[model samples]
Target: MNNQIKLSKEKREDMIALIKAYFLKERDEELGDLASGFFLDFITENLAADFYNQGVWDAYTYMNVKIEDLLEIQKY
Candidate 1:
């Protein structure tokens, strides 16, 4: 499929909640975009991969193919 499929309401909400959790955990705040002093790029990428592997959503898998390249390309 090519982005034609739609996720159910619960699945969509779950995705949003996951992103919210990541943002909150990374920023130590509920709104700010700043991530913890740690290597957030790594953390976020890994989180996305984990989500993809869980068989719930594929939003993150778009990055799965070039993950290694992305990791090498990112500065932080």
Candidate 2:
């Protein structure tokens, strides 16, 4: 069992940046190829093992969080 480790704001921001960079990089690439290589190159990569080691398996958990934040956005 893994104990939950608290992340500093800076650390959390860094992890978010890492995720964005990864997605942006793959955005222009072939989805099929990237999907096939994702398991090893992204999933098992050092960033995964070091930070997001738990893996984001809960789709709704992620989606709801995003939706909630988006809903809170104020349109000028």
Q: What are the per-model numbers of colliding residue pairs? A: 0, 0
Off by over 4 Å in 2: 28-76
Kindly list the per-residue Cα lDDT of model 2 for residues 1-76, writing each as its tens digit: 6544555767655555565566669775333434444433544444554555345546658888999999888797
Q: Cα miss at 29, model 2 (Å)? A: 9.8
Winning candidate number (TM-score): 1
Candidate 2 has an lDDT of: 0.57
Runs in model 1 deviating more than 4 A are: 31-76
- Residue range with the least summed lDDT across 10 consecutive positions in model 1: 31-40
Expressed as tens digits, the lDDT of each residue in 41-75 for candidate 1 is 44445565575556644645666757967788877
lDDT of 2 at 24: 62
* Candidate 2, run of 10 with poorest lDDT: 30-39
Error of 2 at 76 (Å): 82
